[model samples]
Target: MLDEVTFDIERGKIREFVLATHAGDTVHTSVEAARDAGFPDVPATATHVVVAGHYRDQRAFVAKLGLAYDRVVVGSVKWTYFRPLCAGDSVRGVRRVAADTRKRNLRFVTLETDYLDAAGDCAVRVREVLIERGAQ
Candidate 1:
């Protein structure tokens, strides 16, 4: 039971931070290459590492709730890459419930977050999908 569900059935569901990038986050050499390739910035794809981390975080939360694929009540994710974050740039991370829904025979949830750089510029937007697996 996610905390946001309006239904009278579930318990409070909370989101655990999945990933964050900050100053000192190791940037692979490939990121530098992309910047040099005239993309005006490091290839955004490399940032998937952050997303993967968050996914792992989410998985842990699900497990703690005794939920498996067939027991998900809702799921959704949305990510926004705002700008390039160079190496040595401090970044902040935060995550919270964005929205929740039960429809079309399925439950849907969105996890929203943002990463900000030392300069106070948004570097990345994180959106995660949480889907409800039928009760296990």
Candidate 2:
């Protein structure tokens, strides 16, 4: 099964994230700076912001798949950026099960998340591997 969710990339949120992360990059925090840098608007948000959103969308699906919270651990995460996600862009995340494997008492599931921009163009792809311990 696949799970999907959409999120709006608001300017305020981007600025707040920039401040919280101490990014010190004006382009990410100010529209004027981004425009000066040749961007149409504020530059793309920090990668972690999109990553957090992706995980938020995936949490419920993981639980629905019968994976207990305590038993599960993150194995790895990889992100590939195709294009910048500017402020005011609406992005959608589509997550699907990629692989499932069992090794002894451990079970591993790989999830692929495709992030699409407002124009429906793929902007980023994330692959996350999760491990469930003591699971056959």
Candidate 3:
């Protein structure tokens, strides 16, 4: 696993992410609405971590794995949410290469990132599949 990355999920970022993603849920944008819905604060939208990921520069790790940006294509992304993520939560995530295989001219890589909440409980897990095409 690569070194852990930490991010504080803030309210403004959550609201921005919700607005940018066109998430029409009031709970994701307003703390009052979220609290009314039983959340401590504005709840992050699904996949909001993708925005938080910007704080961690994973490009170096990807380059270390020999993945050329031009050759890599994101195959799929899967997220398993174990608990609601709300604004003001500080999360830590560890990323590792879960699998790698080559078939014909295509190389498939599975990267997994597991995130933990401040209480050290699992919050979310993200699995991303990347396909790299060999030069003809």
Candidate 4:
């Protein structure tokens, strides 16, 4: 893994993210609604895991990877969920470079991050593709 960081999943954060993203799902904001939906508590939306970045210094990571910070852009993202991430969950995200290659005039870097729950089980896997422009 290239780096790792752990953070708590708070109810308020989940609610705010739900509202900000217009998820239109009460289960993401209301514990009671989530309970009714068979969840232990308000569950975070899939993309909410992106908040993990706030816990780390991404610029340092980019520098460590030798990637041009100004030229790097997110190309795509994929998420695989193994279990629901709830409001009180504390997850540790482990990041690694899955692939790196140059095609034509662009450099493509594939990064994979696995969010592991408190029990050490992977709750989600995020695959992100970053493209660096003018890297040829």
Q: Point out the worst 10-residue segment of candidate 3 by lDDT.
A: 51-60
The candidate that wins on lDDT is: 4
All candidates' TM-scores?
Answer: 0.52, 0.85, 0.94, 0.96
Ranking by TM-score: 4, 3, 2, 1
lDDT of 4 by residue, 20-130 (tens): 899998899878899999999999998989998889999999888888999999999999999989988999999999999999888899999999999999999999999
**TM-score, model 3 to reference:** 0.94
The best candidate by TM-score is 4
Q: Please give the lDDT score at residue 125 for candidate 1.
A: 72
Any residue pairs clashing in model 3, and if so which? Answer: none
lDDT of 2 at 55: 41
User: Candidate 2, residues 40-63: lDDT per residue as tens digits?
Assistant: 888655464454454474567768
Between which residue pairs do clashes occur in model 2? none
- Cα lDDT over the full model 4: 0.92
Candidate 4 at residue 121, lDDT? 96
* Per-residue alpha-carbon lDDT of candidate 3 for residues 1-113, written as tens digits (9 for 90 to 100): 96478888889988788778899989987778889999998888898878646867767776877888788989999999999898889999988899999999999999898
Candidate 1 similarity to native, TM-score:
0.52
True-structure RMSD, every candidate: 11.6, 2.5, 1.2, 1.1
Error of 3 at 93 (Å): 1.1
